[model samples]
Target: MNADNITSDTRSELPQNSSADAAGEKTLKKVANRLIPYMFSLYILSYLDRINVSFAGLQMYTDLKMTDEAFGFGLAIFFIGYFLFGAPGNLAMEKLGARKWISAIMVVWGAITMALALANSIHSFYVLRFFLGAAEAGFFPGMILYLTYWFPERQRGVAVAKFMAAIPAAGVLGGLISSKILEMGGIMGLPGWKWLFLITGFPSVLMGIVTLFFLTDKPESAKWLTDEEKAWLKGEVEKDRLKAAAAKDSVKLFSRETTGSLVLLSLLYFSLTLGMYGFQLWLPKIIKGFGGLSDGQTALVTVLPAIFQALGMIFIAKSAERTGERKLHVATSAFIAAAGFVLTSLIDNPWLSLVTLSITAFGIWGTVGPFWSLGTSILPARIKAAGIGFVNSTGNLGGFVGPYIVGAIKQSTGSFHYGLYTMAASLIFAGLLSFFSERLLKKGTRIET
Candidate 1:
């Protein structure tokens, strides 16, 4: 029953899957019941912290006398830090494990987010955004690695899907809250933008508390499980990881193979991100472009896509789950989004365009998480953290580039059509890569080659 004996016994049984009776299966049961929810709560908060800027951007631009380019650059600068520090931060997660490390990260970064209310100039925006990116870099990848320990190859997709849903869900919460907070336009010398930052950022204290109480880095360490239960849990995980390892040559956070795929995916993802982030970072701006929506209406409208996106995530992900197919869902979403972008560009009609955009939001951004789930299938279990981090962090370069890309195009041309078209390729590329990657996985016995 000792921890050492439990781990060794678990490792010894790595290749075996002995059927345990209900009583003997407590370990897997506990993980299923406990760890996923715990991680997800923190994930939701972490994501909210990182993206709170977009909601603030709705008002920040006008108040500070900042231009679209200034907003775009400030948004893009977040990724410069992501690019510079993401890989190293993710590597540290692998070495240090997720519990205490992510605990420290969540607390510090939450404080940083709350600090955003203090920004007075473009200089402040640039600095805060970068450090925020650095603070947030390892989260998604670290979580990806964390998930692999709990679920084997078969279940990892759905597990990841649930977490990925948080992105759109964040939009849902941000939209709902910012609409109310915007009414506080003249509270004690603080702008609505400042309130948005302060209130949203302050919740990390609660999130950090939950993390310290609940987050588990590995199965054997789960106090919720009995020693016998822990052994079985650890055994199942080690076996799955070893099998995944056998499927690839290496699984380091920055492995060459993962980096290669990450590069291609990032370029493609950048384009995809351009469309998604451009819209997210500028949804309020876009809605305002339609004329006469009023502040509250715009806030409500901004959340519409994310709401649709959450539903779209379920519907599309279900189809993927049923068919066990990744490409068609992704492709369909991308093409529909492309069509939405075109309609929004050409139309003078607000109602028609907003409807199209609603579909576009859910259809396009909704598919992102599921597509990421598809990427997990191709990863060997050993390097899942590094592989996903490389993919996510590198792909985020698009997030960094996206707002700027569209903002520049919109500023120069007085329209978003050119930028939309430029980003359209991202949708196409991700689908193509996913389609081919599936083919490659099927034809070969191993995923690493």
Candidate 2:
């Protein structure tokens, strides 16, 4: 169907009662107002904990007497645990409930993160990082699945955009905080890098405790919502579920179409993540390479790209929602990011390199909302949790590959140019695949949303 037809069909499904529509809007606002803040906070902390190691690596590499490859392996190993546990962890969340499962994951990961401070050797660092990955494996996909319970298809893009904005928020805030924290060396005879992990990991524990009481698993269990509001929300969700069931011939865990979609989505995510982590983990070092900059100066410079990235993510997601188009938004973002990566590699000027890096950050980060919306929108409700888990787990393998490849190439070639070029190619491939995947999905499954 055409865009106009899709919009019209969507409109036809809306409630006829203006008063009810207003009431529903108010209820949704209330739900979002209550839920989004806590979720956003939790995600920021989660992201910070996961990536603070990059900042720590600025000094910890020399402190622990580690090589570039060893540090890269440490970064990559976290994803191994993440990849292994993703699907099962998500399924466990489905069985055990989000409140309990998410809180548990947070608490355990928080402890593991704190313990990272005590690591005095490369082996211990690897072990701690691996466990940290295992502890935090399902949190992202689990949160995605959790949002599906609260928001319908039409609203999910905005909801997810706001939530995922935490990525860049973590980057900006975490960078600033980590820079200062790194200045705390010899405060207690411990290095600033040790203090970085020690301080950042505690919030997750507190947030986990807050989540236990603050979050509700489903709309039905939320006491803040009235009976009328609950009924309206649940009714709307039920309509989506029934529609998904009716649209698919079978909602099995593994079907040909579903599996194909998952694999494509995985590759798409792999490419994007390669750029995301490669930039994130190495940006500080990249900035430092320009010379004549302190660690604090490098950290502050990293904040600009994240700020722009957050803006790009929110703007692109809102546009995707306004246009009711997912595939093109994702493809275009990837293409823009690919160009940015390519340019960053070729540019010789430091200022120009920073601008290009910002563009790369914008493109890779911008893809998050529309990409998830596209994946989740077409997934069968029956297997959404598991399917999302599978896609996330498989895709995150890129997290491992991205840093490792960059490190390996940097070591071998003695320059980051080759790594940036490789990531650009990956992004270009992803953009092309996303463009073609839209047509394939439309032809094969009659996907509308």
Candidate 3:
């Protein structure tokens, strides 16, 4: 059956035949090609802006005469605003639509990031970081929710993964570029960290403006898609929603099972996030501690883990999609991450440490797609927005805790070993919790992949 033979006028009468199935596959590919690269690029900019502070700290901490504890506090405060606003911000996206709300988010956060270059005191650092978190609150979870509006349940793991591959991509790119930017301290009489902020922040603002014109809100409104493709894609998504609705035992927002699943997922994400940010936010400094390495050398070393992470995450998610499983993948990845963390803490050889960090990055990031796939499936549609928001917001508290604890431990003990051990324990807990979480989720309500 030739997909091209399908026409708009015959759309309704076109049976659920092989031709339509082929058309749907082609349509999904078209959507992926059209959206994913652009979405991937946007996320790269978004994550680069968020994590560049890790690199900037090498210079900024010294210039400002800040303690490790104080610097960690500044990093942790961003998540406070992020936690407070995540749910509300997601709800706002639901009302205002992704196009407007996401654009606004990017613009505000970009401006705050640029403003970070002006920080002269710890007080200013704390204030700007908090506002930066508040400004960027819903962008990540909002992108997750936004993907749901396009892709069906089975396809989300790959879609979410491809989008999230940006995290490591950002890490890799930010390291390479930021390392050079840090070398530019005397350029225009401003320090290198200031240059890093200015360079990284401006692209987001430009991309935010582009998003207003570039992004299509939903398939029904996508002009590039033929009416036949649009109808078929929308029908596919609606079928998934209908199946979810029919299978749900209770449609209520606050059902006991629903609430329980949300809580458990939140905790699971908390552990995963703690390990993620703990490693990511401290990676450059961790490498710098190896001795005799310059900032550029430290940044280059940091890129290796991110490269492994980028490759591992995409491959893991794609494999999970093929196997049509999410739970075990997440648990397995978490366990691997725990092992990596433990090994990294114990290793003294710099090269061996880098190898372990790569393993750690691979394992921690490999869980992202499967985790989100499992999460959205467990939560009922009625509570999805708020449920994801609650999970992400509460879970992100770990971001604060991870960096702060690692910093404080480094301050008191003068080593990251205990901090790495703490993160490993949390990952193990997350791995164990995944099995229990699957049990707590309602049997029928879960969207079958």
Candidate 4:
């Protein structure tokens, strides 16, 4: 055909293309509406269960007469089991399917969390925390992999954002509820921290049973979706797979490029986790250090950072999806978080410090969506399960290190300044590392047309 004839023909097909796009959009909205809220709730519970010890630490440490170092060690031990079992747990989920594996994981961890209330010695605390980590190891990465089944790369950022927003939401809910629960100390001869665990742990077990029936593993199996919608969704996801395959011929898990990318991504995540747990686990204590504040008041103030962080992350992830930019978003957020941490350490005014801490929380937690989206985008389909596991598992060691080092610093130095500075330094390194990640992975990735 002549050039003008071809152009005319293409123009004639535009209406059909537009109609198909509209239908696809509607289907995606339906899937997201059905899945995201439920998944979000699961994550919120997961996070609350993971971090509730921060609230409990208010009295638990005193009740046990544990030193700062011992308490920090107890908190850090969870990640040890988390690191060891993380990859295997993800692989188990891959073998068994999300519904069964995730449910089992929730039941196990929920039970362990409740058992934590029975801890009367530091050694018992250590063992329970470690087991808790092992039980919860695969859940986060499993959810990330699950999202890949439903959302294509273009929409994955926002999907991850919505799911991860639960982190901050958990903080808000955990803080409010845990504060009240802590006030119930000595009722029924049990401390309020004991109540916190008993109350929070039950819902996880209930939800685990609910998940078996509620979740569909893949769109093809989703009876709620029409055949056409299922086909369209699968086609979109396949396009992403094809694009990734085309970029790099090798899908070897241990190849130099793949291995290097894994290390870089792990380091990046390590920095984030360090900042996250360092700040989050210690936040209640930090606020109380401001003096003249009750545990309830401190918990209330802690929620402010989470609220701001939730809003910030959602906004940033939406913007990244709209712009189709990932690396810069991750880099910028890390830098912002690092700066906020540094500023927070320098400032003495409690209100101003809280504002800076909110900014820090915004940066630290905000990196979640774009960072994981970028990491997953770089990995080929063959290695996704192993790659995500390695990244999440190794990276979470920072979770152990962060709280430990912070506790060590607090015990020896009698201040949180050095600890905050250490966190700031880690975040700065992560910010710098994002550029290197772009160089390493960007060449192998192309935006889908």
Candidate with best TM-score? 2
lDDT of 3 by residue, 325-404 (tens): 87888899999989998998898998898899899999988887778767766776667645665676678788898889
For each candidate, give its TM-score against the true structure: 0.84, 0.87, 0.86, 0.85
Between candidates 3 and 4, the TM-score winner: 3
Worst 10-residue lDDT window for candidate 4 reads: 1-10
**Total backbone clashes of candidate 3, pairs 3 or more residues apart or in separate chains:** 1
Q: In candidate 1, how many clashes are counted?
A: 2
lDDT of 4 by residue, 1-449 (tens): 00000000001111148878787788889989999999999988888998899888988888888988898898889889887886687689889998899999998899999999999999999999999988887887788778778987667756765676677789899888987888888899998889889889989988998998898988999999999999998998898778767654655678865777788888888888888888889889888888888777777788899887787667666666677777788889989989998998899999999999999988877677677667766655567656766676677788899999999999999999999999999988888887567565547544220
Shift in Å, residue 311, candidate 2 = 2.5
- Ranking of candidates on TM-score, top first: 2, 3, 4, 1
Query: Native-vs-model 3 lDDT?
Result: 0.80
Candidate 1: 10-residue stretch with minimal lDDT: 1-10
- Cα miss at 320, model 2 (Å)? 3.7
User: Which portions of model 2 show Cα errors greater than 4 Å?
Assistant: 1-14, 152-154, 238-249, 253-260, 322-328, 373-389, 438-449
Q: After superposition, how far is residue 40 of candidate 2 from its true place, in Å?
A: 0.7
Q: What is the C-alpha lDDT profile of model 1 across 109-175, one tens digit per residue?
A: 7888888888988888889888887887766666776777776545455566556656667778877
lDDT by residue for model 2 (181-200), tens = 88888998998888889999
Superior candidate under TM-score, 1 versus 2: 2
**What lDDT is obtained when candidate 2 is compared to the true structure?**
0.79
